[model samples]
Each structure stands twice: as C-alpha cells, then as structure tokens.
Target chain A: MSNLVQTITQSRIWRSFFRHGWPDNPLDRSLVMTSNIFFHLHPVKVNRKSLRATYTFGLGVMAVILFLELTLTGMLLMFYYAPTVERAYTNIVALQTQTPYGQLLRNLHRWGAHLMVLVVVLHMARVFYTGAYKPPREFNWVLGVGLLLLTLGASFTGYLLPWDQLSFWAITVGTSVAGYAPVLGSTAKAYLLGGPEVGQEALTRFYALHVMLIPLGIALITSVHIWRVRKDGGLAANDDR
Target chain B: MTNIPTRTPFSKSSGKTYTLVELVHRAPAQMIDHGPENTVFAFPVVALLELLLTLSVSAVLLFMSLTINAPLEEIANPNQTTDPAKAPWYFMGLQEMLEHGHPTLMAVVIPTILVLFTLAIPYIDNDRQGSGRWFTSERGKRIARNTAIYALLVMPAFILLDNSFPPRELLRGVVPDFVAQTLIPGTIMAAIVIAPLLVLRRSKPNAREVVLTLFTLMFVSAIVFTLTGFLFRGPGFELYWPWNMPDGYNPFMNL
Candidate 1:
C-alpha cells in the first residue's frame, strides 16, 4: 500500500505535469498519434530534411488557413443574412448599416470566400509541383479534386444567397445553364431551383444545399484527404530528388 | 557453414559476402530485447484537442446561423429582367464570352464541355506509377505546362478576335439560335482545351521553360480578357438576362 502510494505520488508523470506541460508517454503519444479522429489531421513525424523555412510545399497549409478564415467570417456574416427574397436585400443593407463591425464582417466573408478558392487552387499547384499527388496519395488527390469542385459549388450556391442583382441574375443564368444538361437538364434545373426559374424555390433549394448538403460533402471528403496524407509517407520525402 | 569458403565469389553485389540458413538474424539494438514498450501518451490528447477545435468551430457557426439569416430578394418577376443576366461570378469568365453569341452556346454546351474537360484532368494525366518515387517526370511537367498555357493564352485571343467583330462582320454578324451560339463557341472551347496536348505531346520542355510559359500565358489571358472586357464594351450586342426587362431599358446602355 505504501509502495503504491509512493509510485502514484512520486512518478515522473506527476512531477513533470507539476513542472511543465505534458507527460508524453509513447503510449499516450501513440494514442494521439494513431487515433483516427485526431491523428489523420496532423503531420505524423515529418522528414527533417523537408522542414526548410521556404518549403514550397507548404501551400496546403495556406489553403487550410484560408478555409478557416472563410468559415469564421462566413459565420459572422450569417448573423444578419436572410435567405428570402423579400428580406435578403434589406437584411444585407441592415447588416451594413445597423450591425457594428458589419462591413468588416461582410468584407471578411466575401473576400475570404474568394481568397479560399484562389488558395486551394494554388495548393493544388504546389502539390503537383512537389509530386505529392503520386501513388498511395492519388485517392486523396481525387478527393481534393472533388473538394475543389465542392468548393466551387459552395461558392456558386452561396453566391445566390446575397440576392443582389449580381448574385441573383448570376445564379439565375447559372442554374438556367444547368437546365441545358442533355438528358436530365430539365429535371436537374428544376430540382436545383426547387421549381422553374430562380425564385423562392431556387433560393430555398440553394439555401439548404449551401448550408447543409455541400458542407457534409466537404467533411466526408476531407477525412479521406487527411488519411491519404498519412499513408503517403508524410509528405514527399524529396530525398532521392 | 560448410560451403561458406567455397561460395564467396558472387557476394560483392549482395552487400555482404556471406549469408544463409546459418546467418544471425537479430537487429543490433534489439538482439536480446523481448517485449514491446507500452507507451500511451501521444494519441488521446491530440485527438481530444482536435475534437474540441472542430466542435468550437462548429459551435461558432451554429451560433451565427441561429442569429443571422441568408439573403432573399423580390420573388421572381418575369417582366423585370436585369440586363446581362449575369452568370455565377465564377462563370464570369464565360458570361463575358456570351455577349457575342447564342443562348445554347453561351448558356449550356460550352460550359458543360469546359467542366467535363476539367473533370478529365485526373484521367488524362494518369501516370502515377513511379517506383515509389516522383509522380511527375520531365515529360509530364511539359505536358502540364503546355496544357495550362494553351487555355490561358488561346482563350483571350479568341475572345478578342471575336469581339473585335473582325470575323463577326465577315460571317454575316450576330446570328441567333443554338447553331450560331452553341456550336461555334463549343468548338472553340474544345480547341482551347485540346491545343496544349497537341502542341507538346511526346515532346519535352525543360522545367524552367515549362514554368515560364505557363505563367506567361496565364498573365496574357487574364490581362487581355480584362482589358477587352472592361475597355471594350459595345452598344450593338444583345446581353442575356435572367428576368425579362422592359425592352429598350438595356441596363448596359451607358456602356
């Protein structure tokens, strides 16, 4: 009983916890390392040679950062937005005139969305340049390509939510273009808009899709992307090159 | 052990001069080690932290969603068309092309072709088997550069030549319907996508040349497109609209 008490009280973990930050048990470490929910999202011990100050392959990080900015700013903008035609324009005006920091929030959300698209494209380019999209990593690349389309899709759907002349007609013509799909264009266009032309039905449909459907798609594909990164041997080693 | 002395001639390429059923098989650091360590510190906390982060982000978005509403406009009024029935901004590049063409061409077929071409990128560039090493070789790089440049360059030049009305005037001018709009633009779109592969197939450009050509063409397309788009709006063309506007109220009248 006395030895057990001493072991619990005087252990290195206890002492370390008392003095510093973490108790990195390799098991605890392995737990963090191998646990799917957390593990796949992080770099599993990177190659030392790849860690230069100017690692050009770091564009993926920039893309993630841009995505995060979009999410945060987009959420803030949601506070004043209404997905209805009757109130959307007024609500946007109210967001600009009534809400404090509204302009800043709007700018952040708008610009962030634009910038995220640009960054994601650059990220794809960087991955291509460094040969990060090779075997063992191809599926992730495909997921990434899907994610790219989703990003464009989300941006396209959300573009309509603003209900401005630019946003509305843009979405109108956009969905109308969808109506031209050869065999299913009619059904696809109607389904997308929830009715015929871009209107209340279209707005409602885009709203549901932008807020719910597309995001779910992103989350599902992102998991696969992170997993492939791990299985791809932790970034391109660049050793032989 | 019996044949070790007699079989030493062919060992140089094998890294070691001898091996076999009698060779030792333990790692230097673990020759006598028996059990795997039960370390358990790295996994749980990081996962918990990530979980926390994801939830926090989700929570914030939820709060915002609850507080804010997405925008809605006046219900669709068929009589009130906005001129330049603009495309989704991402398609701004394509909408900018429609000013000179027909409905089916600008609105449907061309865009579909462009998207289908985009989706084909993975299939078209399928050369990933690389002995566990580089995914792209010199040939691949050249192909990519050429493909990207062709789109970036040829698109603007075609748009310019079209909008310049040089050919439009000569070819009987501004014909309506899918035949006039869709077919020509679709063919042009297809050619823009196909030109690079045609230019660089089975031919290699060095890394520097590839990168430079790609950027140069990208810059040229963007610059020419913007310059022509903004600097060269015309008075004669009928702009497409989402809603029907009262005739003569063309919003682009000033431009």
Candidate 2:
C-alpha cells in the first residue's frame, strides 16, 4: 500500500496538481501557503500576538466572512429576483411564501448585509484604537476607507431592490440627503435615481450596481487589501519597530 | 524525514571562506527584530481559526433567520407617502442631524468632513510610539473614555434643546435663514466638540491623544444620533421612548 501510494504521488499528474507534499513539516507548510492561491493571502507564519482574540476581537475576519456570506446569499437571491417595478415586490413575496427555504435565504442576505456593515465599521474602530493605521499601513487604511464606502454603497443599492414601500421611502429620504449638496447635489441625485424619483429606471440601475459593479469593485479592492496586509508584514500587532 | 536547514552552510569560520566585509547600516532584514520563536505556521492554525469563525457566524445567522423574519412592508405607492420617512439605520445619523441643522450642513458638509477626517487620520497623527496597544496609552484611554461620556451626555442634551427651541422657528423674523439654520447650530456644535480639547490643553495632549478625543467624540455622537433616529424617533419623527412609541409605531418595523 505504501509503494502504491508513493507511485501515485510521484506521478506527473499528481505533481501538477499539488506543488508540495503533505504539510506536516516546516518546508511543506511554508510551501503550502505560498503555493495555494487562497492560502497565499495569509503569511507562512503569523505573530502569536496577532492571533489573540482580545487584540482584534476578530472583527476584520468577521467582516470578510460576512461579505462572503452576503455574496453567496445574494447570488442565490438573484436567481428569483428581477429588476422591474412590477415583478420585484411580487418576486420577494412569492420567494417568501411560495419557495422552500427561500425566506431563510432572503433573511440571511438581509441580516448578513446589516451585520457586514456593522462589522466593517467596528473593524475600522478596532484598527483606529490600536493605532494600526500608522506608517506603512497608511495606504491600506485609505483603502479600508474606500472599502467602507463601497460597503455602504452595496448595502444602500441592495436596500432598494425589494421595490417595497419601506425600501422606496428609505432610498428617497437617503438620496434626498445627497440632493442637499451645493452644486452637484441635484445632478448626482438625478443620476442616482435615473429620474426625478424612485421608479422603474431607478430599480434597474440599482439592481445592476448592487449585483455587478459594486461587488466586482469590492472583490478587486479586497484582493488588494489582503495583499497589502501580507506585504506590510502581517498585522500591526507583530510590529515592534 | 528530511530536516529543512534554515541557516546557510557558508560561515566566516570556514577555512576557504571569503574575507569579512564591513556591515552596512541599512534597513534591517524582515525578521531582524523578531524571531520564529513567537510565531507559528499559518496554514493549519489560521485555516482552522477561519473555519471556526465561519461556522460560528453562520450558525448565529442561521438561528436568527429561523427565529426572526426580515421586515417587509406593503407595495410601493408614489401617491401615498409614509409619514416620517427615514433612511436606512446606518444613515440614521445623518437623518437625525437633519432634524437639527440645515440639510446641506447636516447631511452633506458634516458627513463629508467626517469621511475626510477618517481617511486622513494616519497622516494627521503619524507618530509610531504605540502602534499595537489599544488607545496608545493610559492618557489616551482616559481621554477616549471621558470624551465618549461627554458626547453621550452633551449630544442628547443638544438634540433635546435644539428640538425644543429650534432657531429656524424661534428666530424666524429676527434672524436670517442661514444664520439661524447654519451659523447658530454650527457654532454650538463646534463649541461642544472643542470644549474637551480646551480642557485637555492643560495636560499638553499629544496629537494621538487629541485625535483620540476628537474621534471618540464624533464616533459616540454618531451612535447617539443613530440610536435616537432609529429607536427613539416614532411616528411624525418625534422623539419618544423606544418602548412606548405612539400609534403602534414600532421602529423595528422599519428595519
């Protein structure tokens, strides 16, 4: 059995599939992180201090996880949802009452979105309180601010998708605040609503942004964000200099 | 099992080694200050931790989804407007601020300033004295705590005071619109924010401590306004006890 396993492991096909052997040793462990795309976001070795629960409260990780949850549930929701004034509300109602576990999916997406926003804000506060935004991490902190804005954009756009009274008025009130800006307010508001008020045009535009543009932007920026963290020598907790 | 060698085989003591070169003062190597003694491989540990977090978060979310349904109101109607329409919970801070001052100042200008300040925080206070520690020092922690408490008390008072005696209404004929809506409220807010800094001047606070006070004040005030907008504001946008909203106006219904 050992000979057979060794033969299979030594084959070209297996070698092509995995760059490293079982990660039981230090070399393989290091290789495993550097070799795998997903694992490469993390460092080969992390500071023990960075792993402390109290230090970070894992808020950053929680934010990323929540984003992932939102993405998954969001995609599932897109299958049944349509970006139309006529069908959007009925789609949601039918999704809740007619489909199996659809309500659970919608609930998860809605709450996960709220949780993500809260988690992101808390993560920023944690980073601020810890003075983690110092020096080399400054640009990453800027990126973080952009991420926060994008998060708000994603949530705000998604809020209008249901085409219900709650969503419609919430967005109207929200965007009216934008219209309060001096020169560009009304123009920006018009562009956002695609007209004078919330209607079919606004719904379609928001749907496109909520599903496509914003998520892609988030994914791209998140990639750079994690990469910058790795390049900046892991978390600031590890830095004594 | 093959042992991975970390250090190079070539050494100064070796008989055939090259001559010693002068050490140059340059940026230190990656691991100069710390060693592997205080570190662990991220593969298994971080992966496991992430998996645990994912499971726990999902479990909580799933339980929430099962127990409580997401709120859904009636179909959209352009003619029939909902009384006291509000923004989402996150933007409730801005919405609440709208109740106090001019919309341009409350919604646009102040939020823009806050965002810019948030982004410029690192540049504004670039000191590296206390990177990893929470609140930087004891003084910082104290400043943050005191500022938070100050904001919690002062903001509610400001809201109540401003609501009861709105300059926009009180000085209708006496003062200009901009003066009443913009200048007066803006000046009062600036005074409220700057009061702590004036008190801290005696202690000779550092930039980090100063920023700490300001950030804490703004953050806590934002929370106060948000909670007030989200939970306290009932039908007609009047401040009420969250538990005793009139006309069966449950604020959670809006969520």
Candidate 3:
C-alpha cells in the first residue's frame, strides 16, 4: 500500500495537480495552505484562541456558506426564471408546481437569504461586544458594516423578483423609505425603481440587481473583507492575553 | 533541526560567512506586550472546521427548505395592495419607526444616524486596552446589561405611548407640521439615546464603557422595533399582539 501511494504521489500528474506532496508533515502542510486558492485566505498558522467556537460562534463562516448556497440555488433558479412581468409570476408558479425539486430550491434561497441577514447581524454584534473593532481592526469593522448593508441589499432586491402582490407591495413600501430622504429622495427612488412606480421597469431593474449587480458587489467586497481579516492579523481574539 | 545551517546557503559562494542573530527591541511596542505564542497549523484543522460548518449550515437549510415553503402570493398587481404591507423583515425596524413620527425622521434620518454611529464606533472607542474580550470587564458587562434592560423597558413604553397619543396626530392642528412631526419626536428619540450616556458620564466612563452603553441601547431598541413591526403590527399597520393580530394577518407569510 505504501509503495503504491508513493508511486502515485511521485507521478508528474499528481505533482502537477497539487503543488505540494502529502500534507502529513510540516512543510507539506504549510505548502498545502499557501499554494491553494481557497486555503490561501488563511494563514499557515492560526492562533488557537481565535479557533474557539464560543469566541465567534462561527457566524462569519455560516454567512459565507449561506451566500454560496444562495448563489448555487439562485443560478439554478435563473435557468428557469424570466425577469419579464408576463413570465415572472408564471415562472415562479411553474417552479413551485411543475419543476422537479423546484419548490425546495426556492425555499432554500428564500430562507437562506433571511438566515444570512440574521447571521450577519449577529456577527456584527459579536464583533462589537468582543471589542474586535478596536484599533487595528477598526476599518475591518467598517468593511463588515458595509457587507451587512450589501447583504440587506441582496435580500431586498431579491425580494422583488417573484413579482407577486407580496413582492410588489413590500418593495413599494421599502423604496418609499428611500424616497423619504430630503433632497435626493425621489431621484434615488426613481433610479432604483427605474420609473415612478413598481412596474415592468422596476421589475427589470430589480431582476438585474438581484441576479447580477448586488451579488457581484457582494462577491468582490467579501473577498476584500476576508483578505483584510488576514491582513489585520487574524481575529482580535489572538490579541487577548 | 539543529543540523540546519543558520546562514544562507549562498554564503559559501559569496566567500563571506554570515551568522543569524536575534535583534532585541530598545523600546516597548504594541507587539511586545503579547502573551505566549499559542497557535496551530491552519491547513487541515481550519479547513476541516470550515467544511464541517458548511455541511451543517447547508444541512440545516436543507431541512428548513424541505419543511417550509417560501411564500408566494397572487401575481404582481400594483392595483391590489396587501393590507398592512411591509418591507422585508430586517427593515421592519424602520417601518415600525415610521409609525412613531415623520417618514423623513423615522425612516431616513434616524436610520442614517444609526448606520453612521455603527460605522463610527471603533473610531470613537479606539483604545486597545481590552481588545478581544467580551464587554471588556465585569463593569462593562454590567453597564451593557443594564443599558439593554433600560432600553427594553423604555423603547416599548415610548412605542406604546407614541402610538396611543402620537404627537404627530394630537398636535397636528395646534403646532406647525415640522415641529409636531419632526422636531418633537426627534428630540424625544435623541433624549432616549443620550440619557444613558449622561448617566454613564457621572462615573467618568472610558471610551469602551460609553460605547457599550450606547450600542446596547441601539441594539436592544432595534430588536424591540423589529419585533414590534414584524410580528405585532396587524391590518392598517396598527399595533397588536403577535398572537392576536386582526384579520388573520400572519407576518411570517410576508417573509
């Protein structure tokens, strides 16, 4: 068995696939992290204090997981959905009734959106209460706040996609809040709705935002947010005495 | 490990011997005060932990998706509005605030201020003395707990009081619209937020303590308003018990 494993690992194909050998030893373990795309977000070594489950309750990880789930399910949904007013509602009805596991897909995306918002809020609270936002991490906290708003944006824009009475009225109320802003209110509302009210223009604009613009912004910002975590010396828990 | 050379391998080629030496700091710095080095390799451990989290979160989501259906009402009809129409659940706090005063003040101005305050917290409390600790100290925890309880009591009372005898409604004919709608409610809301800071000031609280008091107030008040709007408000957007909402209006369906 050992000889076979060695032969396989020593092969050029295996070496080309993985830049590092088996990660059973220190050098290989470090190489496995540094050379990989996903694991590269992490440092070669992490402070043991930061790994405590109670410290973070893994809310940040959960938020990212939920985002990935949304992306996957959302893409699958896009394959069947048409953003047009004539087809949007029918698409959702067909998804719920006709398509295979379609209701489940919509369910996951919907509940996942709500859960992500809740998790992000709790993560912010955790960071604030832990004093993780102090000093060197102050800007990271700002980034976190920005991410929270984006999360909310993603959820809110997606809320309008079903093109139901619920989505229509909910958005009408939501955007009217933006219209309450003094000078720039109406312009912002018009820009968001793409018209004076919730119609085809609003539906089209929200669909583009829900499926593209907001998610792209979130993806870009989340990369920066995670990178900043490493740049700022891992979690603030490491600084605890 | 000791067999490893302390100098670079190229030293022999350059015909100059080099020795590794530890440089000591002459003055104290931020990095000097840290505790013992307690760390582990991130590769397998963190990777495994993340995988576990991903699976568990996905599993939980799967269970929820399998059990409950996401709400889908009739097709989009701008002509027909849902009674007690609401924003998304997270924005219910702002919607609840709208019931208290003017839209500009409740929805736009106050929300903007809260976001700004949240962003400004770390800068305002820039001290590094208690980073990574929950609530910093026992005193800090007590302050947070008390402030939270105070907000829990005060915010609901303000909501009920404002709802029953809304200054915006009662003083509408007597006072100017701006004074009745914006100025009075704004002052009351500001007082509610600032009163705790004033009490904390008597003790000459540090930056962290002050932040704790303010954040607790804001956080708990947000919960109160969100719960109020999301669960309690019924038809015509009037306040009702979550269990006893009129017209069979189930807020969960709005999610």
Best candidate per lDDT, number?
3
Deviating ranges (above 4 Å) for candidate 3? B1-36
Over A68-129, each residue of candidate 2 has an lDDT whose tens digit, in order, gives 99999999998999899999999999999999999999999998998899999999999999
lDDT of 1 by residue, B71-170 (tens): 3345445556655454544455555655656655655665565456444444444444321232345655555555555656677667756766633344
TM-score of 3: 0.94
Candidate 3: residue pairs that collide: none
Report the C-alpha displacement of residue B163, candidate 1, in angstroms.
1.3
Considering every candidate listed, which one attains the maximal DockQ? 3
For model 1, state the Cα shift of residue B132 in Å: 11
Considering TM-score, which of the candidate structures 1 and 2 is the better prediction for this target? 2
| lDDT by residue (tens digit), candidate 3, A138-205 | 99899899999999999999999999999999999999999999989999999999889998999899
Q: Which window of ten consecutive residues has the lowest lDDT sum in model 3 chain B?
A: B21-30
Question: How does model 1 score by TM-score?
Answer: 0.65
lDDT of 1 by residue, A82-133 (tens): 7898987777778877898775576556555665676676666566555555
Please state the CAPRI-style docking class of candidate 1. Answer: incorrect
After superposition, which runs of candidate 2 have C-alpha atoms over 4 Å from their true positions? Answer: A1-13, B1-10, B15-32
